[model samples]
Target: MKQQSEMILIGGGLIGLSLAVELKLRGATVTVLSRNQQEAAGLVAAGMLAPQAEQIPSGPMLDLCLRSRALYNDWTRKLEEMTGLETGYWPCGILAPVYERPDCTTLPQTPETPSYWLERDAILHQQPGLGNDVVGGWWFPQDAQVDNRRGLIKTLQTAAQELGVTIIEGITVEKIVTSPDQKVTEVQTNQGIFRADHYILTTGAWSGELLSIPVYPRKGQMLSVRVPDDFKSLPLQQVLFGSNIYIVPRRDGLIVIGATSEPVGFTTGLTPQGVETLLSDAIRLYPILKEFPIQEFWWGFRPETPDLFPILGPSSWDNLTLAVGHYRNGILLAPVTAQLIANWVLNAQTDPLLHHFRSDRFQTLR
Candidate 1:
């Protein structure tokens, strides 16, 4: 009989909790240490699972996102089956509206999910409420969204707990204690020192604080609005990806509008300019949004690398893995990240998909 691997996962965000659930399902005893689970970026995200809509050039990052998007249907279904919770996994698709002439040069179209240009009348018929400047747009039928705050985050937490993954909240990991042989022996936290057979860092934006990784916080401010019950028409059925803004509508009349990409370091609070700009751009994209009442105001820090890609696979230290710096795609990439990390930890199998996202990729650039 084989012994179960004892794993300690630092960070209890969506990425950490998802990975913890995966590790537990793979016969590993997992414990997750979360600093502040409520403040996790996943909780604050608008949960747009957009690859083509994001206009990512054809590359490894785009490939990673599309692969994760492919796994979402099965992944969310399994989680709901196990925990009996809905993750708000809506394959509602996305419409990238253009104020000027439509151009498909920047958008990468995959054979599995090809995006096509929609004429002005066609787009208006599909989604009626649009600003007057809107002409035509590209339709990404495969792009989808999840209600991260209201659905997926809570569902993932429930799934992890139901699967017997020990999650310790409010405990901050101060440092990673390594030995002379470059193996993580234990983690030094505010509470005390804890040891595990393996350690995985999914700390998101704070990854650089504990290790020499290039992960840093990229701040984003977002807000949500809800349509009034007496509104004349139905709420938006699909996500609208406009210039520097996205409008994601939920089944329950809650529309999420975001965001601003500020390189500010861990700065908290929503600025007046940030909110103003979001509302200005959002209203211009969807004219009816101005009538919706503001529901919430918040912000979060995305873990970003210099190359704007994730740092996955093993780190320099033995028995320690890197799964941080997901930037804007943490919610979308959670399933694939969990699966790949679990495979490497339990079976020692490294998927070729992880080849471009290794922890040492930044070192080569230096």
Candidate 2:
């Protein structure tokens, strides 16, 4: 019998955990190392699978987003089956209210997602909670969301555990050791040295520390507010996208409001200005939000690349593969990224899309 390929995954975020499960399902022996699972931004994301709502014009990133959004249904279903847990995968769609006519300009459209302009009356009829200040807006029926913090992570971690994938938490990988031939052979961590046949990096913002990648932290401050009992109407049933902020409603009566994009470089702190801007923008989208009590305030650093696109597939090192630099779309792109990486590792074949996300792109540009 052929020996199972042993793979070491650095970073147990949604991407790393999901990749571990995928590799295990493909008959590989996988071990995942996470410095701090709770610190992962994946747990804090509002989980908007809005390829059309957050369109990337026309490029490889758009292709990746749409493909991953298409897989959420099946992915969540399989996860639910394996873990018997609800992933809170909601296909309730997204509503982008146009507070001003200029906000509607350059509204994105995609062939796969069904999007249309809703008139002012139609907008109110669809989601009656919005403020009268809103005019018309774009509605994306194909867009969906999940509860990443509580729902998605629970299912993923449970599923991975049940699949016999080993996950070691609170273990920080200090550096990756490569052979003289430029092939990754082992990883040195705070806990100990671990050797594996293959090494996969999904360390998000910390990717630069392990490897000389251009990945950096793009800090985002977010808050969640609980729905009040005296509210006149039901909680928001769809995501609200306004000028520069978005309000995502949870099934459990909490609205997730976010975020401010600041390049603060690994620094952590919630600023008053950030929170105020979020509240101001959210209230402008729906005046009723003022009645809700603030439930949580937190921040996460998104792994950003120079081009703002993910660095996927093989890296410059022979046995090292990259699955980082997803920025704001990490949660949205987790499923397909896992599938593609697992497929490439198992088959040893190059995927055509790998060309677009190669980690050596910056070096080539130099």
CA lDDT scores, all candidates in order: 0.89, 0.86
Question: Which ten residues in a row are the worst by lDDT in model 1?
Answer: 102-111
224-310, model 2: which lDDT tens digit per residue? 998897767557888987878889988888889988888898878889999999998888889888988999998888899999889
Model 2, residue 115: C-alpha shift (Å): 0.9
Candidate 1, which segments miss by more than 4 Å at Cα? 1-5, 102-108
lDDT tens digits, residue span 188-292, model 1: 888888888999999999999999899999889999999899977557999999999999999988899998888999888889999999999999999888888
Number of the top-ranking candidate, with lDDT as the measure: 1
TM-score of each: 0.96, 0.94
- Which 10 consecutive positions of candidate 2 have the poorest summed lDDT? 101-110
In model 1, state the lDDT of residue 250: 92
Candidate 2 colliding pairs: none
Q: Clashing residue pairs in candidate 1, if any?
A: none
